[model samples]
Target: MLSRRLISIAGAFSLALTITACGTTTRQQVGIGTGAVLGGVAGSAVTNGSTLGTVGGAAVGGVIGNEVAKKKK
Candidate 1:
């Protein structure tokens, strides 16, 4: 349980770092990455550490984030 929580936290932190580092790039990429990270974390948490759920969440999140970023212009 604790380990899972740690992993989730690490994932979130890693995502934050990734997004921040890429902030200067295209907003679409940043949004997609952010979404993927957030979705992965949520999916992992909800699915009790299922890899499939995490990946699926990331994919969906990435798409949504990408669309949103593109619209922000």
Candidate 2:
């Protein structure tokens, strides 16, 4: 039961990201989106579909992605 819920949450998260990623055209945007998807999936799996976990994971992942995409001067 819990596994099913987690799967659903991950699926929904992935779908949402896919829809949103369609118009992205920058490395930062791609990074953020990819991070969000991976984070959300990992978060959901780790937390058993916890809303906070998924959101927090996405936030953290986005920050990480942004940093990774930063250009060195």
Which candidate gets the maximum TM-score versus the true structure?
1
Model 1, position 22: C-alpha lDDT score: 50
What TM-score, to 2 decimals, does candidate 2 have? 0.69
Look at candidate 2 and tell me the lDDT of residue 20: 69
Clashing residue pairs found in predicted model 2:
none
lDDT by residue (16-70, candidate 2, tens digit) is 5775667756777777767777777677667777877777777777778778877
| Per-model lDDT | 0.76, 0.71
List, residue by residue over 1-73, the lDDT tens digit for candidate 1: 6587567647765875777785476777778888888888877878887767777777788888888888633
User: Number of the top candidate by lDDT?
Assistant: 1
For every candidate in turn, the CA RMSD to the true structure comes to 2.6, 2.8
Q: Which residue pairs in candidate 1 collide?
A: none
Which 10 residues in a row give candidate 2 its minimum summed lDDT?
3-12
